[model samples]
Target: MVVDGTYAKMWISKGILYFVYKEIYEINRIMAKQIVSQRLQLQNENSYPIFCDLRAVKNAQKQARDYLAIEGAYMTTALALLVEDEHSMVITQLYIKTSNPTYPTRVFTNKEKALLFLQDYKE
Candidate 1:
């Protein structure tokens, strides 16, 4: 199943949940929560790894980041963040470190690498 939202699009493949954030004006808490809920439903409550393609995302609000981190701690088994540039990589790293996420997390510039990393969490 695929779900399209204002700033993100989500789908599931090989038992993994993927969310691609579009290049938009802003990303806030509400949108993040919506995406998470949609993803959870798509998986039918079973735990799964998540791959987030944030390469197109220009900026995200603090509230959105916080909400994702907190909620993801319980819902996500592992997280793979696909980032194209150094800035995005740094920002992703900061969030992971600050949030102290429960799952294993990593940042990669290539989608293949991200998917490969997330495969570890696949059952």
Candidate 2:
């Protein structure tokens, strides 16, 4: 476990790093860096798929979203996001289209589907 806060919680499962945001909080570059760093330290791998549970996240700062969508690509083989609302889905899709992440990225309404999609990667 790298971070356990009122906003987000991070852990690993089956070699896949998981980040679950529990509340609405602005994600800045510093927070993104900490997330990537903790993922690296906890997973101890060159790269792996990330399953993000963003059902609770109200919004993410543009700079932070940009950094994670672009530079954070190197740390992840792919990204699977589970979003429960249309607003978040649209926001994530917009980021994907604008940032053009090198890695595969997808959004799902359920964690099961997201996990299944991420499982396709060898990691």
Best by lDDT: 1
Show where candidate 1 strays beyond 4 Å. Answer: none
Query: Against the hidden reference, what TM-scores do the models get?
Result: 0.90, 0.85
Candidate 2 residue spans exceeding 4 A from truth = 1-7
Backbone collisions counted per model: 0, 0
Whole-model lDDT per candidate: 0.83, 0.77
lDDT string, candidate 1, 74-109, tens digits: 668899999888888987898788888878999988
Task: For candidate 1, give the lDDT.
Answer: 0.83
Candidate 2 per-residue lDDT, tens place, 52-118, comes to 8988766678887877776667678889989987777887888788888788899888788889888
lDDT, model 2, position 40: 65
What is every candidate's alpha-carbon RMSD to the true fold?
1.4, 2.0
Clashing pairs in 1: none
